[model samples]
Target chain A: MNTSENMKARLVDYIEAFNAADASRVVALFADNASVEDPVGTPLKEGKSEIETFYTYATTVGARLELMAPPRGSHGNSASISFRVHITGQDGRPAHIDVTDVMDFDAAGKILRMRAYWGADDYHVLADAS
Target chain B: MNTSENMKARLVDYIEAFNAADASRVVALFADNASVEDPVGTPLKEGKSEIETFYTYATTVGARLELMAPPRGSHGNSASISFRVHITGQDGRPAHIDVTDVMDFDAAGKILRMRAYWGADDYHVLADAS
Candidate 1:
């Protein structure tokens, strides 16, 4: 089992890499056969190829993540983080989505699966968005 | 599908009920067939009977929960909350455990499954504990 410290460190790296817009750095945290189901109900992006594409698009977008609290690690092969994703809404207004991501790690310390939890109502247009 | 508002409301209620030390109130939020996996790797407490027993002990232990972030809702039948469980350690010292709980709701808005994420290292004795 991966140590709690190691799992939490990786989660921190994910946030930093994403905020830096380094898609490669973000993708490198996942296993080759990893699966990502962002928003929990969405179709999964499977394998490194698809996962790479997903991160590329996500990183390129002007989205930034702000941690809501410290990352949490499980006794099992999982860890979780809660954050807000700031982005431009369809109407060109600044908005943020409240999200919690749970990641399951492999023996190699790479993310094997990631599921993000965020509902439609979680999106909020910033009051200052004009 | 349970509405996001309803899901989030119940999560709030759960915290309130727990803090109130009202085990019955907390148990009422769960489905008849609900299953609870506290701390991920632990054996599950299945069904309302087992779940009720689990919460009864939890609530009676003088453990208090402090939310680290707002409850998060998913597009599907799930919601999550990150919190700190404040309690007395085995040595009778003040301690806390950082935990993230994910709940899957049934169509009727009752929690069908609940999983808590926390590792052994997540439990920490307060600095003031001497």
Candidate 2:
């Protein structure tokens, strides 16, 4: 597979691992010193240990990501993925969060940096009926 | 128009001004103290003067942006746009750069923060024959 295709596959794998609540699998996709900053403007979590902790907490939230659009613009060592995250809110109702993650990869194809873009407004507490 | 539509219109206007190489028009879309980090990992250009200088240099590169996909996931005050930027390289040949810009808006609807995501590898020099 070409670089773009390879990156796309890795991206899909990362999401699948997240949906499966496999924190180890998700964390393995990153380099030893990778950094993740969810929501772009937040502080970053660096290194494998910190990344694992972040994902561990994330997986416990029972969030499932559904791709809103096919991953777009994979070039060189960078790729961007957009998806809708479904999770149960504190009120035991469904919540939807729209997120776009921009990732940069290292030579070994491990994610070196991940920046997720979304704001508080990107989240919606779905009606209980739906 | 609602918030999403308004943000989308602002995004389109930004691109249109970029394609027109009108630096003033392009910079006007941003707030006076807006911050722009093109390519995500770069040091930010903060404030109108710095932002205008960045666009000034960019516009001089003879680049035109073509939307690769409709602006996606505008919620609250954030929006993201994916596009292909065509530019004439030093070799006097066409170069295509794929870019994704995630922007945050202020209450006044001007861009408060703009983060452009793309790496050097996202650029390709088209063959003259094409």
Candidate 3:
């Protein structure tokens, strides 16, 4: 795959891993030192260790973000993508957010870093009586 | 500067450029093809030309994002940063948001890509009755 396609594929795999609760797979897209801060009661995972720990918290309480095409520009070893996030809030309300992400690549085009920006509270959280 | 410090300095410079309405300085941190999507009524500027345009919108509204230290981890050419945004909403509310950003670097530590995540609605926008 090309750089952009590979990134798209990797992002898809990340969502799949999250839905399936596969920690290892979710961690695979990152380099050994990748970090994340998901905050907003989701997954504020940082670094390889914390990222693993953060994903561990999602073993039961279901949360998923179905992603659409992102706003993006790719050049050489770097690309920025913005995507619409459509998901059912934990409480089961209709939730949506358009997220923009910028990614840097290693010489081989592997994901070196990924940053995301979105309006999380725009999501209406319903009462999760489940 | 070190990778992390260089990134921080660049981020600071970006804010300064915005405050001063210096589009050229703001566009310097990015690679020739860098992109931006500052949604939520801010700046959804993409590509070089669009980024320049987005900054143009802020010239008169007097908008600014006073950034604090971000949550971050940097090793090699990658890092994730989360920071607190304390800004006077267009309506002049005591608005605040904790934003997380992920950045990637080229082999030379030049920023190649950047992604931002924030709660814009969480931002208390004053009615800009200006």
Model no. 2, DockQ? 0.14
| Tens-place lDDT digits, model 3, residues B1-130 | 3444565556666667767867777667666566553422234455767766766765445555554433232433444443444566655565654444555556555556655544323344445445
Candidate 2 residue spans exceeding 4 A from truth = B1-27, B30-79, B82-99, B103-130
DockQ of each: 0.81, 0.14, 0.04
Predicted structure 1: lDDT: 0.92
Q: Could you tell which candidate, 1 or 3, scores higher by lDDT?
A: 1
- If both were scored by TM-score, which would come out higher, candidate 1 or candidate 3? 1
- The most accurate candidate by lDDT is 1
Q: For residues A7-60, write the lDDT of model 3, one tens digit per residue.
A: 555656667787787877777767666656342223445567876676666534
Native contacts recovered by model 2: 0.04
Candidate 1's C-alpha runs over 4 A off are none
Q: Residue B60's C-alpha lDDT in candidate 3?
A: 45
lDDT of 2 at A90: 83
- What lDDT does model 3 reach? 0.53
- lDDT of all the models against the reference? 0.92, 0.81, 0.53
DockQ ranking of the models: 1, 2, 3
**Prediction RMSDs, each to the true structure:** 1.5, 6.1, 13.0
lDDT of 2 by residue, A19-125 (tens): 99999999999999999988666678999999999999999888899876456444356778777889888888889887788788899989999988665666789
Model 2 score (lDDT): 0.81
Docking class of 1: high
